[model samples]
Target chain A: MAEEIEISISPTGQVTVRTIGIKGPKCVQAAEAVAKIIGQIESRELTSEYYEAEGHVSGQIEVRGRR
Target chain B: MSSVILVTPLIIANWSVISAAVLGACGAMGFTVASGAVSGSGRARSGSSVTRAEIEVENSEVLAGGGGTDEEMVVEKDGVRATFSRDARGALKVCMEGTGYSKGQLKQIGQELMEQVTQQYVYHRVVTELKERGMPIVHEEVEADRTVKIRVRNW
Candidate 1:
């Protein structure tokens, strides 16, 4: 999947940045890069996807049996 | 799918970058740069009949050098004149004046101009930094309410 960064700037000068297609700590890093350029980060929220392991698919569970 | 960040913009840039944003804002608001000198005729004509209003760009710091000095950029449109300068503390200050307009009107114009300056500043900073980091903008748009939305793809 292609990694993407989405940025929204309100008319009042507030900025909101979100990272798409990037998972784990790298996503935070991407967002931080943007924040550093613009200004100070007031708040940050990590989505559930951030906790997902890299390259891991959602709702997929593997069963292991003793061999 | 990772994180969302809310930011308050701080304009800490050299004169050229800040001037670029000022020009962008002026163009968007139908104002034209009148002079590059602080002593230029861009000021509101001095008279008892003129009303004046000043506004400060929040969280901003305009640096000197890079073709910038202790000068101000003046812009004018429709009998209204605005001067952009850095205050003693280095924050960006906008002083607006016009003969026929009231203080409220001038304030409104100054407020709008400041907002536009901020938007333009953020736009330039984000786009430039992203490009430097190898994430070029894939899509850009201005919404109906003047909000700017930018999307960049990381390869």
Candidate 2:
């Protein structure tokens, strides 16, 4: 899947960048790339997808039973 | 989504870029560039009766040692006039003057113009840098509130 970067700039000059289809450290890199282009990062939040391994598909369930 | 980041824009560019942003802001606010040659001292005329208000663009720096003119950009709308210039420390400064408007009104206008300038600066920087990075912008739009949104896909 192709990685996508979405950037939103408010009228007041506040910028928000979101990275999709990318996981792990690479996601941080993606955000950093945008920050480098724009300005200093005020805050950042890493979602569950960030904890997943790169190239891992989301929404997978792991079942554990007393078998 | 993987990560979301909030950024505070810092304007650090050459005169060309900064001037472009200033012009864009002026156009958006219904102000016309009056002259490219004007005093940048940020001082009101000695004998003039016009009220003046000056505001600085926050977190901004005009990169020094450029080839552009030292003369400031002067823009006007109605009876009010504004001057866009760089300070000694290379920071962007705006001065608004008008006879009828109160000082508070001039400051408000200066603030609004600065906001628009910042918006235009960030928009140009993002688009230029993304294209340089080989990211193709698949979508772009400006909302009714003047907010800009851009999407780039990295294949």
Candidate 3:
């Protein structure tokens, strides 16, 4: 999948980013990649897509009921 | 006994940071660092007072959350709930909401909301960065969209 990552810097200096094509923890990897490009973070807000595309960590999988 | 000073970094950054930062309709202004910022615009006929808040991210790896030795966890907030995550591109994303009241014109209201959200937005970002570095947290204060007061000792 060709993911789209968008970053916006407002006139006042606020930065906003939108990533399409990924979700969940993988999206975190995306964020880590981007921040590495830009710099550091002061604050941010993300969308559900981030979680979805990021996918879940295998370590978090839990077995219920029997065993 | 190791005093509070013991936990904090002994050396500070080279740049002088702002003691208090206010994120207006635009982004944040203060501190030597600037990342994850944006501006907001309003229509011609909206009005209302503004409410602000700050979001903090604990347990972050300096490089994983965003970038630099000081990384921030990206997040976005709706009217009440805020979503957090890192983008594939490495940008900290945040979405937030403002008060529902109509206190001024559309433009004014929009500006107020933008400021309120961005302040909290910036708050979360900065907190993430500090935590990633394993720096001791001194103190933090949230004041809606108007401003946020943070005091931390340097390493």
Candidate 4:
């Protein structure tokens, strides 16, 4: 799947950046740069999809039970 | 929603340094500067019971380097005139004067302008960071909702 980043800005100046279709650490890394520029990260919640194996990571079938 | 990171922007700066961003926002929002430019502290409107709104820029800096003891920018449009300046605490402050608009209406307008200034400012900063990291932009658009969407990827 193609990687995509979607950013939404609220009427009150809060910003939400979501990463889609990326795997493992790459997902967080992809969103981090943009996040840093937007403002202070008031809160963050990682989705279950975050634990999936990174598509580009070689020979890795990483997965973890829901926490 | 769990994959989302929420950020609250704190914008602060000296009026001199942020003049360009302010001007960019003004132009985008259909505001025009009556005078070319002015230095030191000044008010655009006098003796008006205009609604006042203030937005404090968090983690922002004065681009002018020198102290912002005396710097201001005035922008006007039809019924509105706005003054941008830095407070003693170094936070950028905007005051708007509009005769016909209600207090709530003026506050809403002020907030919208702040958002535009912020979005425009962050756009340049983010694009530069992307270029530095060698992540070329794949797609970008200003959605109908006025939200900017930018997609970048590493080749």
Alpha-carbon runs more than 4 Å astray in model 3: A1-67, B1-104, B142-146
Question: Worst lDDT window (10 residues) for model 3 chain A?
Answer: A4-13
Instruction: Compute each candidate's TM-score over C-alphas.
Output: 0.87, 0.88, 0.27, 0.78
- Ordered by DockQ, highest first, the candidates read 2, 1, 4, 3
Q: What is the per-residue lDDT of model 4 for residues B1-155, given as tens digits with 9 covering 90 to 100?
A: 22678777655444544777778888989998866555665554555666555655556655556534457677778787777677676666677778878867777777778778777766665677677877778888877877777776633
Residues B1-155 of candidate 3 have per-residue lDDT tens digits of 01110011111111111111222222332212233422222211223444433332222111332223232222222332122222234332222334553323323433443344444444455466656765454655543543344544333
lDDT of each: 0.86, 0.85, 0.35, 0.69
Best by lDDT: 1
lDDT of 3: 0.35
Sliding window of 10 residues with minimal summed lDDT for model 4 chain B: B61-70
Per-candidate DockQ values are 0.69, 0.72, 0.01, 0.39
**Per-model TM-score of chain A alone?**
0.78, 0.76, 0.54, 0.73
Query: What tens-digit string does per-residue lDDT give for candidate 2 at B90-139?
Result: 78898899988999999999888899999999999998988787889999
Ordered list by lDDT, greatest first: 1, 2, 4, 3
Q: Candidate 2 lDDT, tens digit per residue, A4-66? A: 888998888889999888878888888788877888899999998798887655597899998
Q: What is the interface RMSD of candidate 4, in Å?
A: 2.5
Worst window of 10 by summed lDDT in candidate 2 chain B:
B38-47
Off by over 4 Å in 4: A2-12, A55-67, B12-17, B48-69
Q: Name the candidate, 1 or 3, with the larger TM-score value.
A: 1
